[model samples]
Target: MPTASVKLAVIIVSYCNVDDVDRCLKSLGRSDWDHFEVFICENGGEAAYGKLLTALVGADRTLQRASDGASALDRPHKRLASVTKCRFQNSAIVVRLGLATENLGYGGGVNAWLEPLLGVLGWDSVLVLNPDTEVERRSLSELIAKSAEGFGMVGGSLVFDSAPDKIINYGLHWSRTTGRVIAIGRNAPVGSAPSSDDLARIDAISGACVLATRSFVEDVGLMAEDYFLYMEDLDWGRRRGKYRIGFASKALIRHVGGTTIGSAVAPEKRSHLSIYLSARNSILFARRFAGWRWICHFGVGLLFAARYVLKGSLSAGRIALAGLLDGAKGKTGRPDVAPRPH
Candidate 1:
């Protein structure tokens, strides 16, 4: 029997990664838990929405439901996104595609679905997932179990999809002293647990895979949209109020890291956007939460920019400096640069 009591809505805020969304939807289709529906917000706008429809059809050629067939009350996020293109009722998965007219960044994209899904459609919980991640069959079950254990927000273990034995992170460690956000268990072997020392400084869970109860969201409020992309998850974690955060190592997931954004094994080879947003968000975060220590965050941004210069990536250094200046000038929301392509 389905756990009708636990109404979970898995939210995936996708930019332009239709293929990744397809694979992720296929993965979600295998979930053992039977009380959840998926809402994918296509933040990449109309073109990506077209790609999403094609991918959805390819993912499941079984049932087809046109937007005109759905009632206004049945389809949530339609007020924000376009609407569901097709649906699959055979498995536990129910895919609803939300097409945005413009890029909503990460937080904005996720927020587009939350208000309507949690309110009008009526789901008690939401699991924010990256389109590039494929969760384990028991992932949802573990997250719900952890949340039932009293955690208002819960995160699962994330391993690299390319190197399944290597872990991406268990959570995140936000450094006040150095203004660095380090993955708690970066590159560690699979199935390893975070030590107490590591857990002590884990200020936030990785946004790659996080679940939150409706009560916590209603109390703490929705994720801040000011951070259009990076650092929004850390900001969300810091605002948990009286609620507690937890980790479910058993809820294993494989993440094709930085799919929408370019990445490299080496720090110097990372994309300009990644470097820029990281440096900018650090200062913005400090200013809002770090009191006078915002200066330290600014200094850290300078250090980051210098790293690129030392590594002979002057263009990256320039972008990093721009991010620092923008953050210092109280810049909020998405940068004016074009997003990476699908």
Candidate 2:
């Protein structure tokens, strides 16, 4: 297939975080690849956040067109080598917003835009990214290049936004026995490089930033919507067998982990919502995929709950136990809980 025919669609799912969305869009504006479109999927955020995202998209579209014109010929970037001049002239990268009437959860928000993205827009590939992530200028190009090399699902390197020099994840590994998802290179210095073999295959890739081809989506299907917020990526990776998952080390993305779910909250006082969803999803994933091994997972979960209790987080421990019970009973969807008092 010709490079021009390989169109990229970028999808970002956001909820009540307009500032992070703004920063993410600005970073995207610096992308060297010009053959992509951005879709912002707003999942039941406040009206103010929706307005801000709309305004930012308008400004970004104008700026992108202007910059494309100014740099059309003069000092052409090396990354534009694959792009034909004719295609570049006719193609206009656009940013669009898709607002949801209600909270669609993480998987649902991205799925909501799949029809229009794959069918109406006719994009060949889709990059699902979180609103709290900022991509490096060459990130998209690197991911697209890897995709062309036949990787069905390609993920970028994620670095900590707070500690720019520290790596957060190069890929992920899910253990069926323990029902835990492990980060491949957590907290390692960015300068340290992994062996080529290590980068070649991983159990899974972080959903914070992943690029998937249309063929892969068609064959493997979209993220499991029942997971709602957590463990959907693990489920997707574990189930897909037709295509291999790859990591693009050259593509760098800075992620502010848990921005939407309060990563900043002290471990001892973490929000009930976060604790509940994580526990419930882990059990659900284990039971669905691990079969009888869920007994081992239950034991591991008990240890986790006990740790929280030892740390004086009584609420977190109790919520986690409740989640485990609910998940075993086949309960799903967003749970109703009152907002935490300020």
Candidate 3:
């Protein structure tokens, strides 16, 4: 298919953050690119939030609130009319909303939309975006242009939404020996760009904003749902062989990091859900990909748990240990933990 004719499908999976989603949609409305579609997978939020999303898009469609035990994939597709009908943009920019009966987590929510999007809608490329991100007007265009150059997967440069000049992550660097994944260019000024060599070959891209071709998805498969929240991107990147992963410096996105999980700076304020998932998924990912190196990670995890305990954050340490044990047993999905005060 011609690059110009190829349609890009932007898929965003959201939970309860209606305001963030609204901002994302507004930013998309200002895009200079014309041929694209937006899919919002509402993964179990309040009925009021769903209504708010409908109002923001100004698209008329019957909204259905999912009940208990209803799977996200089982929810019917709700097609909304194009809010903007200009000749250039026309109905070419369409927004579709899908309701998940309950929270499917990040990977599952994306998978719920990916099947119909690529299978039924027949879009050429798909961009998996976080609900807490806002893309620059030229961001989609830059990503599309880079993908056309034979890169199967491309990531946009992500900067903090609060401090637009600072970089959150360009991509990631995975260390096999340590069984650790580090975000490249994190907390650095955006002006300090990585060398062209580093940008040309990235270990993995942030799931916050990534574009993947249909062929790439078919070959590598969708995000592993086993990980409800963290490290699923690293798991996806491990499959990279013939397909190249790249970072597009021109494409920019602003991210409000940890909106769902709570702020990273305040460990005391962070959610038990975030802490447990990170701990569990890291070990699980290491065991799956790093083999014997998982032992190294386990040791490192112990030190972390010990520190939390020494610092008097007993709950944090306990949660970490619980995650480690569960991961060792190959258990997955949301843990049954009580909600702690932020």
Candidate 4:
């Protein structure tokens, strides 16, 4: 059911990078495509920057404020009593300028806005771009064309910030041996073309620069919200047997990768949530999709964890272990502040 009028809804979820969001919108304004609407999902910021973003992008830009809102999860209201008792009384001093609600990781933030973009706005395709990214003029056109080939998901070439020709990630690849996923073309001396065949058929693509058709959304469905920050892309990519996922190599964007978490955030801490989710969700994903293959996958994860600890990223190992514990406890939400970056 292809529509004659294809409207793309581009969503950028903003946490702390107001400058990055401003640059992203400027890049989007230079896009060659015409039929699109952009929205910013704001989770934990003052309304001032959000208002400034809306002014730059357009007055029609939708801003979904997560602050000052009730928990999306249903815990007993009494449980929040303690968190509120201390913070609520003093909240009047800074609540309006600070985060009103809890942080919804990448999946939750994007889904919050995208669900409405699809259900209410009747958009035919949805594009999820990171705030820290700036797009090339040709990127949008290339993504739309690749997506038209019946793939439920599509990703573009991502370069490091401002190094347009230098590739950051051409796409993502999964390692069976380590149960690890690596960004292809990571810091690879810039401007080498990726495999055309690989681009045409992929296991998964990064959510960083991806587009999904309406049917893709209705069928494969929105990103799994349980993953607060990471692995949703892998989870989405694992669904490829039931859906199509491809790469638009011609499309290009730049990422200031690891903005929220520092490069030194320790592999264990940096990847704690990732390790836990990769472990638990890999099992969950395999149970639903991969079958016996996950046993082998868990073995690979152990080896990978060992490699991280051996490399002196004990924090990452700690985080990964914590993630596993949380997953085992069936926890679903963002971890607090990530140990303040050492």
**Which model scores highest in lDDT?**
1
- Which runs in model 2 stand beyond 4 Å of their true positions? 45-49, 53-91, 191-201, 264-266, 338-342
Candidate 3 — worst ten consecutive residues by lDDT sum? Answer: 79-88
lDDT of 2 by residue, 110-167 (tens): 7766654444545789998999999999889889888888888888778989898888
TM-score-sorted candidate list, best first: 1, 3, 2, 4
Off by over 4 Å in 1: 1-4, 58-63, 66-81, 339-342
Against the hidden reference, what TM-scores do the models get? 0.92, 0.85, 0.86, 0.73
Candidate 1 lDDT score at position 104 = 75
Task: Report the backbone clash tally of model 4.
Answer: 11
What's the number of clashes in each of the models?
A: 1, 0, 0, 11
Off by over 4 Å in 4: 1-4, 45-101, 185-193, 263-296, 307-313, 328-330, 336-339
Q: Judged by TM-score, which candidate is best? A: 1
Query: Where does the lowest 10-residue lDDT sum fall in candidate 4?
Result: 79-88
Pairs clashing in candidate 2? Answer: none
Instruction: Give the TM-score (vs. native) of candidate 2.
Output: 0.85
lDDT of 1 by residue, 220-240 (tens): 888888878888899989888
